[model samples]
Target: MELHELESAWKTLDAQVAQQDVELKQLRTQNLRMRMRGKLMRASFGQWAQLGIGLLFALWGGSYWFDHLGTPHLVAYGLAVHAYGIALLATAVVMLLHLAAVDYAQPVADVQQRLLTLRRTRIRSERVCWIVGAVVWVPIMMIALRTIGLDAWLANPAWVLGNLAAAVAIAAAAAWVMWRRPAWFAKLSMDGPLAEVERQLADISELRA
Candidate 1:
């Protein structure tokens, strides 16, 4: 759907998140263990979903990568095809978040210490991404620079830049998704009540503070 529509859907969920917050507080007072377990379930569920998404995309991307362009595809063509891999790879990344705004409402389904724990875990995941970028992306970047050099790479570096740019955009979008609906980020990227979900998520967050 369109961005604004996504935002609106997100808003509805945001309200739910706030409502969940109150429910969680009540659960804490009513059933401490259930509340904690609920959090654990939510966290585990999110991670599992994200792992599945990433694996699916990467595998699909790999298939697309080796799917074959033609009887004699050049390196450029290969790279272009591989750009799909990058996009899929980006989709696979699951930001550490446990909000149920997107996840439970439509198809699937967290708590406070649980929220905090999930947040901490999410932070670590981002760090891991950063680390992975350094270990994997940097070497490739250096090679890119060497091959294309300062001038050539700079001039119409669409091939090199497209992957990086897509990655950056995906990362930013994923980050936002995680904050608002970690489960949604894990399950789906392009869709997932983004418009309403975002609006609700914003309101939920605002309500919290």
Candidate 2:
């Protein structure tokens, strides 16, 4: 073959290889994005479910508190329940907002950071609820008894106080454990969709590097 012809053929082969590489990268990115979107959709659905449950609790607590305005003990119990419901509602709303703020079109690193933030927020909220719930259930139980025509608090103040003390002790112990060994209450597993998305992002990052 002539020298010029040989050079032309090599150029053509290089261009083809470059084009294929570009196409492959694009395809991988698209696939990763689709999978990430699916994970986000599942997470969003879960947050929506949480929001619905929070709404129910808030309404129930609000009604109970409004009805027991005349009784101080009942009012206190209702208010405690109402506060917990509000906390749940607020946490769900904040999580939904964070999820909504995630822009999939952004760089993989950026998206991964946002998702990690969301995961941390979820974990923190769960921990807060765990500690609070230990005590919150006492009020919930009190309200339930009241609904069943048993004013347990008024009937046996000592029993009610004992139960309340136990709840406080339990909540205090849980808080101490969480403060000392933060990983013990790690409810969210690393094998979830979020983790999968993170792995995909890491792969993409490595490719770019």
Candidate 3:
């Protein structure tokens, strides 16, 4: 009887979760519709955050570009610096283009299922984009490093140390986000939204008997 009672309680909990999931989905759709209808709202801070990052990169690239202007060795270090600067500009442009193309107002339920069934397939497409970007830009970084050479003045304590530190910080940030917000990239468990739907199924099962 204890086992049966425990099962009964679980079934009830499952049903409640399912109802909540359905409600959440409906609210999401309505929010999207509002967005597409030009009633979509973004937090004021989000806009400022985007603008601030863009402004910072702009200032950084500008300073980096201006500092290296009309250098003695145009083909060697100068060319590489220009190329690296261009890469930063290109990345910024691509990011903006991607932002422009995305229609976040459309809510697709299939996203959840797609994450499960097409992980490899989706990754292949994603990797292709990365590969193309790398093919174009990795050579630029390599050329820049080669041009500057390992023993150059700027390459010594300032530039090299800065690059390594930036790389480490990026890796740490990625790891932290992956751990704290696993669902942001991949589903951690079906227990979240799916389990509730299962409870609803259990309730229906009881009604049938």
The per-prediction tally of clashing pairs is 26, 0, 4
Cα lDDT of all candidates, in order?
A: 0.46, 0.81, 0.43
Output the number of the lDDT-best candidate: 2
Writing each residue's lDDT as its tens digit, candidate 3 over 1-209 gives: 69999999999999999999878766755554444323112322333454455455445445544665664322333343344444444444443333333343332333323323333332232333333333323323533565566433344556544654665566566556656775654433323322333333334334334
Can you rank all candidates by lDDT, best first? Answer: 2, 1, 3
Summarize candidate 1's per-residue lDDT along 45-87 as a digit string, tens digits. Answer: 6556756655554464345436544523223333433444354
Tens-place lDDT per residue, model 2, 1-209, is: 99999999999999999999988988888888888788877877877887887788788888887997898988888788788888888888888888787887998778878978887887777777777789888889988898799999889999989999999999899888777876655534334666676777787777666
Candidate 3: worst-modelled 10 consecutive residues by lDDT: 36-45
Off by over 4 Å in 1: 1-30, 69-120, 127-209
Residue 161, candidate 2: C-alpha displacement in angstroms: 2.3
TM-score of each: 0.32, 0.87, 0.29
Model 1 has an lDDT value of 0.46
Greater TM-score among 1 and 3 belongs to 1
Q: How far off is residue 105 in model 3, in Å? A: 2.3
Give candidate 2 misplaced runs (Cα > 4 Å).
183-191
- CA deviation > 4 Å runs, candidate 3: 1-24, 28-75, 107-209
